[model samples]
Target: MSENKGNAFDFKLFKRLMSFTRPYRGIFIFVAFAAIVMSGLAVLRPFLLKLAIDDSIVPKDSEGFMTYVILMLVVLILEVVFQFAFIFYTNWLGQSVIRDMRQKLFRLMTSFKMQYFDKSAVGRLTTRAVNDVETISSIFSEGLFMIISDLLKMLVIAGFMLTQSWRLSLIVFIVLPFIMYATRVFQKAMKVAFEDVRNQVANLNSFVQERITGMKIVQIFTREKTEYERFQEINKKHRKAWIRTVWYNSIFFPIAEMAGAIATGLVVWYGGLNVIGGGAVTLGIITAFIQYAEMLFRPLRQIADKFNTLQMGMVAANRVFGILDTRSHIEDNGTINYTNTKGEIEFVDVHFGYLEGEEVIKGISFKANPGDTVAIVGATGAGKSTIINLLNRFYEINSGTIKIDNIDIKEYTLASLTSQIAVVLQDVFLFADTIYNNITLNNPNITEDDVIAAAKEIGVHKFIESLPGGYNYNVKERGSMLSSGQRQLISFLRAYVSKPSILVLDEATSSVDTYSEELIQTATDKITKDRTSIVIAHRLATIKKADKIIVMDAGKIVEEGTHHELLENEKGFYRNLYEVQFADGGNP
Candidate 1:
């Protein structure tokens, strides 16, 4: 995030990236071999031109001329073949690396704690996975090949020039140091410029994503014009960044051209004098030297261009590495008795916070028996959801201990803890897949009968059956194809299918209509009959049948009793919430 950071290309990071390609080392080696062959063949063309000029054209030898012409044709044919092989192998390597990186990143992102997602933007993370990976692919396929071929060509051409005419080669080499210095400066400038471009593009992408996702809010508030102006501002900044990048590149390339031209002009002037003075410089040798001068410039120019691309790739690499570098706030130790868990959950003097010095759950304490239904009721942001999040170990407690079956929760593997717990959140997020797939996401091998039974238990089977595609109905992105109540029903089915020992329902019935809510409540009662349940609800009426109810206010438990006992306390927060709901016509 810092603008003044040094070059984003870290050698250690590249070394780590290369490890992923180790599995396909054979392919990469073959790609490099082909590139070397192609570059070698490319250098042969200039030598053939020199041979034709000195042996055939100069001496008027038709037979020799025909032979040299045939040799040139053969070299061209081999060059084409090697070029094909080079492209094919590098393409294979690039795609394979892309696939490998995507898998690793996807696994890491999914395994990261919820807290990471809470602090990061979805759009930025998505860009790293998709756009950053693509930049790497381009580097491997095109940039890598250019670097190898150009360097090889430069070396071969320099050796040939020295062998033919060391004096002219010396003259051309005089400018080499200056060119290198200029290139180094340009590379540094381009690195900073490209990093700026990448950051600006990411900012623009984030803006677009946020606006699109919140389009409904913008329209409802009649702020479309304001949002458009905001987008224009971001767009203008992106454009300026791109223009600056282009301006730097434009100046760098032309300056490189001028340097090369100066070197060639000096070579031509000096070579003519050597030939005129009857020195060892032949017309063919001088011609080859000129060709070598032109060839030398090519590699320098290519190195410059490759550096620009490498800078962009490094910027992308920095973003991706930043994500991979983040240590998860919560990770389970590989110690757990998953095969036999009694499901006794307890929060003993737990203290927690989302930020330092600001506690969200202050000294909360509770114990749930193996089959108790404990409902937590509170106003929004009163730490109701925070309690359930802690129960699932999505966050680590600042103090005290959360124990499962008398063992600290941290002693259990995260997978073990999460697998034994099912949560139906307030906002259901269904993937763009079939309804059957969404419900069976945790247990893909679940039988069709089990799927139908889980849906029936959540009172969603009838609605699914009514769909034209039945259980195969597509949910679309975020369940946009279904109503809010139907999406909640599907989420309920998903949780029910898992049959977790601990079921946490956070506003699970808030979106459901009265008829569906009644059916789901009845089904929930039956399902939790022998399982521990923790329900967080704003609707006080929904948890009236709970075995125990805890009322929370300002991150502290203020009341604890059965539903009737809490209702009997006229001065309690729970009683006040109940009265307010009843006064609102008992709808909740």
Candidate 2:
């Protein structure tokens, strides 16, 4: 996601973000019209004052003076109305555009493959969805529309000045080139600083989220002081990044103010000379010129400020578009429909690597017939889990074919294929929700009675009844409120309720307590009955009754037989693995 190193004003990205406003074009047009009207109305105030002073006040004409004052009042009222419309619609347009963009970004994120998430940070994606999108919003509310209005106001004021006195107009605008040059420099510097600030924000969020999620590990290792110091370092860098932008603001605004003051002083000094020389100039024009000079230069100052907002918004857009442009998605082109089938699976010469040229599953093949229980046993890094991952098509294989019931797995839609295969992993993820919702996953078709019946069949209904709220009890984030064994049982019940054609248990019994183990084994018996089951087990005793056992070593199938048949081979890998577990007094 960090590959977006774009310019301060990227026209390509600007045009892309503007496309989101297409739905609200009517509102955008209204805002632009209001801004133009407001700019024209703003220019009228000074002209009205000039008329009141020169045409009425000087000659003591009371009626004319009142007429001009009343006209000024009317213009002020119209300006207020137009200003209100400008602010309201611009803000409305900004919020509407961001709503569409946020949805698009989030929806696109959900479609990316698991491989994309493997290397991406959760906090970075969060920042892109929330903070970066908010920054883009300011482009309209505080940046784009306001810049247009200010630009129009400056142009109109400049035209009025030229008509009134060309000499004073030239004098007042002499410092403009310098202000513009300074603004450009400030803008370039600020772009880099704002990007740094955003990067640091993501870093800080990533560190905090990971640390909070693993707080137990930190405390168990007694690394509180170390972690605190690490946090302080990240926080300090975040502060410095923001201070850099503040430092740029400190320099730019003061220079803009100084330039405006200089312009006003030049106008006053030169216009005063014309009056002393008895030129065809009234004091009213000089006074009006002063107001006009301020009106013109003041927006220039604000433009510098608003341009900072515009730059940041564009940077954010670039970042968001980068994510949207990612092509790392699993293709779902299969036309096959999902239906009941006799459970069977076959892997033919399958080869896969999580990273390029680092094959985890190399030319492996296996088969599980209908109602067959197949257990895969191996040491860590022996590619036991990779097979299950491949069966689910979580990651595309480098080269191979996996079929179910004599049909290629890729020929069926991912949704259709996955609906028939249920997997229970060692680490179970539960939302901060009720047990019933977690078990049924909020499936409307699965009633409470269905859940109860399934739990009872698996011998876990008694444990559920013992809880304070029964099935309604809340399991907090990641099921932190429950013991490891209890959480495993919930996962088992969740899988059982799905009624899958094929069930996979990936090291589901390795880390649980004795009581949990017994409950899981009972649940396993009920779930795997009359279905094709794949058990990846670290404990040798858990799969002793399997119809077939495939022992993997270094990504190759070294032994394949029933438990008793494999045990008959004295030096076989499976026999060695089982005997070693028994020798260490571990479960076997």
Using TM-score as the measure, the top candidate is 2
For candidate 1, lDDT tens digit of each residue in 259-371? Answer: 89999899889989988999888888778877889889878988888877777776787777777777885766748745435678888888999899999999988888888
Regions of candidate 1 where Cα sits further than 4 Å from its true position? 1-10, 273-279, 339-342, 584-588
User: lDDT for each of the candidates?
Assistant: 0.83, 0.90
Q: State every prediction's TM-score relative to the real structure.
A: 0.94, 0.95
Candidate 2 wrongly placed segments (more than 4 Å): 1-6, 584-588
- Candidate 1: 10-residue stretch with minimal lDDT: 1-10
What are the per-model numbers of colliding residue pairs?
0, 0
